[model samples]
Target: MLRRLAPVVLSLLVMVLGVTALAARPQRSAPPHTADFVVVAGVAGLRWEDVDPRTTPTLWRMAERGSIGSLSVRSAHRPTCPVDGWLTLGAGSFAAWNGNRPAGGCPQQAVTVERPDGTGAKLPDQESVVHYNQEQLPWGAVPGSLAESVRCSVAVGPGAAVAAARPFGRVDRYAPALPEDPTQLLGSCVLSIVDLGTVAGTTRAQREAAARTADAQLARVLAARPPHSLVLVAGISDTDRSARLHVAVADGPGWERGWLTSPTTGRDGYLQLVDLAPTALAALGRPMPERLFVGRPAVAVDGRPDLADAIAKPLDAEREAANQRAVAGWFYTLLAAVLMLLAVAVLPLLRRARRHAGPHGPEPVPRRVVAVVELLLIAAALAVPAALLADAVPWWRAERPGLTFAGVTALLVAAGTAAVRFAPGYGSTLGPLGAVAALTALVVGADVVTGARLQLNGVVGYSAQAGGRYAGLGTVGLGVFLAAALLSAGWLAQQVRKGWRPAVMVAVTGLAVVIVGSPYLGADPIGAIALTAGLSVAAVISAGGWLTVSRLAWAVMAALGVTIGLAVLDLRRPVGERGSLGRFLAAFGDGTGGLTLHRFSTSNFDTLVSSPLTVLALAGALLVWFALLQPWGGLMRLFGIYPAMRAAMAGTAVAAVIGGVLGGVALDVAGAAAALVVPMAALAALRVLDHSTDRTVPTSGRPRGVGSGVAGEDGSGSDGGGTGGVGPLGDGGPGGAGGATGGRDAGRVQPGTATSDGPVG
Candidate 1:
């Protein structure tokens, strides 16, 4: 009874314990002392690669002496232009222009500054931009929020005016351009923002010239800087339509040479454009407006590599992210194609195998073609993890990145599949399923537990450039991890004694949940909730393949408890220490979460249509229903004979629903299940189809013929290698078509075992 109820009771208990422990953790230290003045030097399309020692000496010097990181310039739209970045920085929130792009891609920055009072300047159209972000978009950005937060501010160029102007378009002080000798301009206010112009160009030489000019301007500003001031330099936006990582650097008290990070993006060496506003406010010792600002103060952790080596890091990351962005869509299409081709080939190939066999009516298909199909299925099942592993290689730098990436992934899949399929005891249904499931679970689990480094910009993983996530499991990772973990639980249940099945399932799934939601690990609270629900289904089904109302109520309770616990846990963390989920909840509590649902709905809908995982999901469903669930597929028979497998399938269904709705990547869950479960189901179906072809039933296909070996659902047979050729993976005794019976049996067929002429099992 305790084993049967383990998942229901233990999962809830462990989550509570984890939360309690976190609640007791020590509070973090306070922030650095405030600066007298905060100077923001904004540049559009600045990249770390553009900072050359000789040409851009000032910028390079700043990179070496100050804390530097790659800036994620994501706003409400992809490829955030100069105006959008400026507006977002001023608002301290994600902002965008809803208008269509200009012919060259991004809209040109043409700010018309009016001399309102003869001493200050005003923006003519700044109010419209403010209204769009606050009223029309989900971000609720109010242009000039940074300037509004301070008593007075200064602006040097057109872009800077967008950032420093008041809601009604007034700037305390504004200049058309920087003067050669203007210490008074910067010292006019505690907050000053100056635009260094655009550094991105279509040609290398053009970019170099732009960098030189920006560096010269920066040098002049630094020379005239007031004492006890904090300086911030950033590539604030994309120059064109395509998004990429930009440069970020901070130099001030307690911000000496180190890596830059923010609570918004927990990972080191990464900060968002929104963070710039919060950083400016923190530098000037202003109180952050929780309702308006969605960013946290930036922190610079000590330590960095040599200047040259540190510079190459962001450059390399950008290359990989760009490569993945280009090819990720096609990779999903290829996976869908693989599933479709297998669906098309299965029936025809099986029919051909039947025809090749002698007219011994109802005999098993005897062609090696089945082995080829099974092998291909095995490779497809492990494709996600294989693709993630492939990221370790510089396939993106190859002359043909897409093709090179595909080939490398294929090689990895072949290698992993071969190792699993050819390992000892492969003949047993448990061996192949267990090995494949465990491998997938282990790879994804280890990645999430560690830093998920391989998942960054991976073909099947998320990129920092997207700005939706940073240090934890992305939707794709969630899908893969949940599917593999559930299946792995099922496999472990099979190895234990029947009475201990549900107990083991609970243990495995509980550990997986901890890793997925621990804040220090996967940092996916929703994933933890979803997986707990799914595994409870597996646990109940394994105990007895029934989902009564009582069991469902318990499962729902466990999931809900986890959800509330995660939310509470996040709320308790300090403002600058909370994850994305906590920040959302905080924003929601402050009334800004009103449009969050609208935003999520729009994004989820867009992903549903644009992602190729949708095609893969549709194809997988067609194949599963038309081929596996149908009577002829033999999978239905296997489920009845193998309760552990039934438990795995049922649990996966529950997970898909919950994870998809909450994680906003529904098709990813389906695709992951299709990749891992479909192939294993196909293998099980093959065993059932070839059940009678082994030595036990023989070519005579008669019920009373000489009994050879009948491979039970567990693949244990009587004696002798069965005549069924399931490749080198199995022998008819104890493990499948060539399955072997219990060791207790010598050469005799076990009692109560079914024959070709009798009912199955």
Candidate 2:
């Protein structure tokens, strides 16, 4: 009982302590000076020979108002060093110990070194840093760096103790203690810090002063600033074109002091400067978990998020570049799939539609010619102002601005002109001119009044915003133009079916401008209106082209059926703002924009309708060619001249019967069988009946009047001397049942002749 009670008491005590800590924590707030945040990163200068303050603002900005310093690291005594600046910033470590790079190549022989106090030290040369393991500096303890957690001595070895007590280091002492918790370090670890000046030429006093400044600045900011939201600019630059980085806190106005330095070698100075980025971002409310030597930020920061309330940035430049290269293969594959389907469905139709359009076939009007004409019309209309009204006064221009709507509006006006010109008898120029003038007035008025209206609304609603210049009047005018064009074409097609071809051409012309001038639409009603108008124009073109040859009623019924089906399919697709069918329809009603329905499944009927008018034209082609069987003995009968035709027909019938039985029966299959067999059988039966009748008639069945000295008793002709084979009318002339005579007037009848009301002989 006491054991259970003890556990309960301990848990309660822990919970209360946590509650107290939570309540006692200070409220977090960003310092005032960080209101206007800016980030300045320093990379190795590409033009180191000409490095200047103007060229290296990141280094000088801190150096001018502040100071500069170098740092040192315990690296292999070689030359070249390469490590990311950010990694050095994180864990406050330098490449000397934290990073895994040697200065240059290993020495060729054993080398001797003099310690700071001039004591002799000797070591054999090696090819890699692995050889320096025994000689490596015991920088300090890192709390979590060890595989096994173990306590470490707070006291350094005798030689190292003297080194740690030095006032500062331009290169050596600038870095932070390694193995994070110096007291817990069981072995050596990499250290990180600011760069003091180089030890090669700097005095002890100068390096010591730099170190004190660095330490004081760090302490001041860390104490006063909130735990979050800070930036530190601590680094070194020299009169020469060389530079180094250091550590300093950036909080509020109070701690805006300068840099610190150390007396260290020039090579070590460069090694220590790589730590700035990771440390700065870490202090500024960023997570830095992973440890890297130079540029690697800590693992804690997996992704870079935008400022708390700022608009998100675009995709990372590196990621975008990689994706562009990857997407090309996929794009080409989709294109190939669409093209293959088009070829299979369209080739047959083309062959058929052209079958009976006379020689030279039905010529396809080149899309290029229409495109050129449309472009010329737009250019000419736009050029009018350059010739006449460009410099006109603002008010006058607004009242009669001919150029603004000229590109799209001109084509409609021209089409209307051509319509009147081509119409029989009731043609005039006034109709088109009046239409253009009215459209211009409506557009100009809307453009001028929108600002005033918006101002009035702003007074009342506080947030009323006038649309952009081309939005109000321009879009409304465009909508009206497109609607009128559709209505006019519809009417013309009704009047004369052939006239519908021109309407199709005109709408297709408008489509070119929409595709080419998409950028001009802007970001408001104007763009939306343009999109709607472009699509509606395309629909009209499709509808008009279909109407060219098909009966109007058939075309209308098909269009209506297709429109409803498309609306349903669109509703089924996953929808958000752009793809939502409900919103698309609403937008259509409001005359703003609309959505196009793409084809889903394949059905012959669906293909014939949803496909271009080109397909219907092809179907007509089928009628022109294969349909010859209707006029000239149904093709099977022609083939019937060969007895094999009968066998083919019988096979078809058997297949139809089997299919019907196995498929649970379909009326269509039985009807199909009848269509295949009945006509050929009827024609065959007619020929057989005519042939049998001819055999029954006789050639000498006619009488010779019974006298007058001839072969017969009448001596005109003899029955035994008469010709015998059948005559043209099957030997069954009007004179007698067994008659077969070629003469028309002497008891003979003509063959294959039709009487007044019917076929007769």
Candidate 3:
């Protein structure tokens, strides 16, 4: 027994060592030099293509003379509102802000403010600070906006001025235009934020005209600044569908005229809004703060004109318009396919029930048809992962996302077909399902272990351009789908053998959960909780643990213990080192937990009602449940026949449901959880049907495999050979006469019988 356990124990030890080594790696050091001054110009809803030399010559010149790239300005939470974008820019972290209500009428006494560090503090009631109404103020501005600055920072215009002054600090606000020769103002402040409010107009024409005006203003500001000062002009929000991609241009000391490469994305010509603060700080000779920020500095990269043009081309009005339509069309198509598959699974049951007239069973489906269905199922299973891999394909870039999606799907289908045809035992009852589920877990788990490189560009993974999550398993991929894969794989593994097989399967499942849930690894708080609860329960059952009320209670307790323990550990880290979970706990500790809870609840409800994919997923889940309870009783019989397999399935099913519910309540979209439950339930139903049909026996007379005169001690052919008769194994009765009996008989083959050659019914 000890020898058998050695491999599993050693594998776990190696994984632990790897995680420890990752944790001990050296941190990024501070930059060697500081910029004389930093200039931040905010142009809300400005897109790269909007800056033409004809109308906006000054802005065009800036792009020509500086490093230019598309900026991802989405917030950490859902909706990715403008408020969230600006707050992320200020905080250098994924931050949240609920709009503030005036405490008192008129000038508003004691305004409430929320910060990215997950703290809420009431600002001192000063008339100068309370000058603007909530509309004039950026949606999530808190007290001490400029408090993050190490030295003097100045703000100009209503937007930038209010954001800088709201935070608890002394900020000089210039609502009026700057002086023509403002060398003193440029020299005194380390940071200067100028808000180009002309772009705030609602219409495209107005905004275009405003852009030209803002360009002239920017030129004046640039001329007034010292020569060595670093200047950044950015668009903080999306003006319209065509303007969804924000614009950023940087120039001055240590920066060259070329494309921008952000450490956050590791890609040239792309930057996130959260990267703004850290990059600014770095230019001011500050170390990249550990843990608190999610972005890195956007550095100048020369000789990448082609790459820059390719990245910028997608922002063109024509391309953006096409991509929007493609996204919507693709989603509906995928949803339709899932619905069609559900229909295919249920049609057979309905037909079987309708034809109750005779003993003639329905004609068997042809092997070719069965094979095709299996391949399609495999294709569906591989969809997300293939999408992830497709990102690396040069032809599959964002400019032609719809075509890329189709190409990836076709390639995966072909590969899955080849696997089914060439791989040994893949056509067996449990083979395809088990292989797909196991492979899915392995790919996703490996990606998490290796820093999610594949997942970073995964069509189904987190979007770098969206600014929600940069690394780790996303809400949909790891949070929902991966959890299901682990459970399904673990359950299928149990059906193959007993003893150490189940133990090893359970151990691997547990390890995958740990890797995906680790703060230093997967970095997903809600995903960690969902996977831990679901996989832990499934693992326990796979290892031969019962699901009695008491046992289930303990499993739930254990899952909760693990979740709370991890959260507490994260909370113990310094504020700068904490992830989303840590920040959430800090908010809870600061008496602002209710706000966070409300945000999640509202988002979940909205997603459930509004998302077409989520509605279809819910429908699919209901169909699976209906099929399981049908009078044919395939699911019920399969469970009774295989005790250990039954335990694993039941535990996993329960966990999936629970995890789905929790995930919906906590994540940005409820669809992620639904994605997990639907596929798992559907596959389990398919497996049951595949095995059950081959093992059904006649209700009267001698069974097919039993010898004609074989009799029990009762002097009858094995308990009268009726529906209530003992099975061929002489152990089970009635409903258990199918594959369950065959399985038992296979182990005790009698001589001079066909039991060893084929299934005994």
Candidate 4:
């Protein structure tokens, strides 16, 4: 044993020594002045005019030593300041391809087309398609190819310094294709990868953290400096004030038209963002890629050039008209319709309070306030449907009228009536029923108009028309449906408060709608469509649970109807499709294929069974479910279960079962797991639940610690002359009861009792 221990100790010592020696070894140093080339780039939301020369002396110094010019950005689709900044520094072709073409010709990107005779599809392929922004960073692709093109030891990416962590290397090129829904995308959409402004400007605390992260990245780049390094420094010099300047530096100095500068008065604008990329590439001694460069870099122009001289000149009559027609005609109409519905529904709630109250009457009950609040909540009801509609529209057209008006009016009316009548109260089964009817009508309408296809593609737009973006109207419709469902649920909850039967009726009504509407809205058969519908249903249900029953019901009903309406819209097709139900259903699923009865057993089953990560996620979810179980919980009590522990366990089991169903598991396995796992997990998780339950005694239990003046535990008499009770410290004294204890001694007495100074004492 001693011999063996000795050898082991010796080995450990050697290992430690080896590690120490390795750590002490000097690191290899970068070669000095043996650079092939250096490249620099800039980022968006910045302009040259706004940059204070004194604030950025290093940039000025570099400019004096090297060439500075305004960079022209070339983009395939709509003009994107961020993408242009990132790609200009990515690789170079020529000035002509820099995304700015005076003639606004065909996009630099390759196009594919099929022959009229259907022999084969023709592919106008280019040498290599370089996606400067979207691909390199976020997608984690090796940027070595980009580096090799410039023959540089290092390549710095383009991004706003204040806004970027590294550089603006990755941007959402598809943004132009996104829908133009002010309420949905512009107002509420949080596409993090695409919206760098939000990411950078999240909060003061977050910005500080981001700044630190950026500093660390800069340090890393400096440490890894190779001979032929490409340093692309892009970002706003400072965005704290009104004036903001964008600067991009490629290489160190002395590159032709390499440096670009942009200035903007506002924090975020387009022009400044467009100047950073090509300038940086020029610094690297590589000509701007023909596919990207359109004209001169920003700094190249001593003053702002005429609009005509800019690389991205306006399109001529026919092209511009065609582009305008796609959105201005149908998209604007949809936006108007959705906006109108919102205006009509929300404006009435403010008036409800005045109508319900009398000048001198007692204050309204919590229920009445809830009713008033619900009326005001029309905006919330409209929001989800608008989002759904936006998702339904394709990126190309993005906006269409068909999706906006679909079921919106009926949903609004149903929600309004339910809200008003139930003021300080809640909706009844009738409201939800009405909502379901409205959604059904809309769905039926879509189906009929689509030629009886039953394929539910862009029907309402929000229903998942796969591979499409910017379907705004569908989003609005979905919001309506959810609002309706939530309203129904709230109404039932209120009924339950008054009497269990009414609540039960309301719940049943909502469940019925879910069962029926789910199919029509493509929430059942088509996977993607079903997913959205189910989520909408769940969201409304949760919302109803949060507020008072009456309030909940009205809100839910409005939300539900809106959600369904939004879910059925299709943006790719025109408004004419709105009047056709046959085409609508055909889009949901292949009509010729009928309903895919075997999908559950085949595709869905196979996918679920094969993924281990999915299985682990399911397990984690089960743990959370068990952790929330409570037998005597309010939910269980509402259903008549008095035992809290039992109720909690049952809830857990139900939750687990639901989770399993959502995870698309086999019924047998889900059932078995629900039975075995839920009970055991619930038992283990009971500790947390037990702690959360209130431990306070009932109001009638005892007179809360007797005041100083009161004697007996009942706290009835004055301390001065009444029978005094034992003091808190248990000193049996008359003064201790009220005077010494300071209850009645200081001339203070209980509201109904007179002090010793008064005759009553």
Work out the TM-score per prediction.
0.89, 0.18, 0.71, 0.24
The clash count for each model shown is: 20, 46, 7, 174
- Model 2 agreement with the true structure over 1-761: per-residue lDDT tens digits: 87445533543343233223212211222222231221221221111212124333333333333322222222222231222222222223332222343334322221222234332121111112222222342211121121111121111222121112111111122122222332222122122222222222245454444444433433332333232223333332221212222222233222233222111111111123333333333333333333221221211111222221111111121122223223323322332343234334333322232112124545543445423332232222222112112112221123233333232334543554354334442211112222332232233223223331211111101110110121121222222223233223322222222223333323322332232122222112222222233333233333212223334444344334333443454445332211123334644455433111111112223433442322322432343244323322223222222112222232233333332332222222323223212322322222222221111112243344211111111111212122221112223123221122111112312333321211211
Order of the predicted models by lDDT, top scorer first: 1, 3, 4, 2
What are the lDDT figures for the candidates, one per model? 0.75, 0.26, 0.53, 0.30
Task: Give candidate 4 regions above 4 Å deviation.
Answer: 1-106, 109-466, 469-477, 497-761
Against the true structure, whose TM-score is highest?
Answer: 1
By lDDT, the best candidate is 1
Error of 4 at 246 (Å): 39
Cα deviation in Å at residue 28, candidate 2? 37
Off by more than 4 A, model 2: 1-475, 487-761
The local distance difference test score of model 2 is 0.26
Write down the TM-score for model 4. 0.24
Give candidate 1 regions above 4 Å deviation: 1-30, 348-363, 692-712, 715-761
